[model samples]
Target: MTKQEFLRRYKDENLTIGAEYMMILDKISDAPLVLGCAYDQGVWKIYKTGERDGHYIIKEYASENEAFDFFYELVLSKHNRRNN
Candidate 1:
């Protein structure tokens, strides 16, 4: 999706434009699976590359430390994504 589309889609979700982020991932099938995060509007957004393209937000949080812990679990192959 184009930048405009991304913004339009997630705009109502409270994700601020140009938010700061950090990506930490493990390789799968020779490709770097993006198990990463971005902080916006005082919330931590966790994303991972998967069957769908784009930065798919798996979860959001108010605590940065909690977000990091979530990432740690994800990297260790412990966390599971649940869609609502």
Candidate 2:
């Protein structure tokens, strides 16, 4: 997605992009947002941060787009439930 669109969609959060990685940080907690990207065993992967530690990962994904979509949907679902 375009940087402009990403910024518009996730305006509530903080985001930083690097040469090999994109880091999405939570605005309130300062925690890494969405998941993170990694290349493992000759393949690209994405992972979500675990609750225990910064290095801890809760889940992994094989496709970057699927990972991003899932994270966005999760956030939207949480928000909708909160508003209800």
Candidate 3:
């Protein structure tokens, strides 16, 4: 999915958008969870952000669609776990 499409679809979810990244925040602390993505150096990167350790790269893809697909699933999984 495109960034706009992902945002629209998860408009009700806990998300924060930045110039080069999108983050899914933790409901309790309003801090960013591990789930997020950023674009740099012609590559789309999926990453996990920590409260203390900083961000870590999970994967990289050549296209936004692939990166977003992985990101969307991560968000859905987190949401599902929270609901259940």
How would you encode candidate 3's per-residue C-alpha lDDT over 1-84 as one tens digit per residue?
A: 877777777776764343333364221122344466767678888777656566777788898888788878877876676556
- How close is every model to the real structure, measured as TM-score? 0.48, 0.41, 0.72
Q: All candidates' lDDT scores?
A: 0.49, 0.46, 0.66
As for TM-score, the candidate ahead, 2 or 3, is 3
Q: In model 3, what lDDT does residue 59 have? A: 84
- Per-residue alpha-carbon lDDT of model 2 for 8-82, expressed as tens digits? 676655332323333543311224444444445543344554444454444456654554555556555555665
- Error (Å) of candidate 2 at residue 26 is 11
Candidates sorted by lDDT, best first: 3, 1, 2
The parts of candidate 1 lying over 4 Å away from their true place are 1-32, 78-84
Candidate 3 residue-wise lDDT at 64:
85
Task: By TM-score, rank the candidates, best first.
Answer: 3, 1, 2
Task: Tell me the deviation in Å of residue 75 in model 1.
Answer: 0.5
- Candidate 1's TM-score reads 0.48
lDDT of 3 at 2: 78
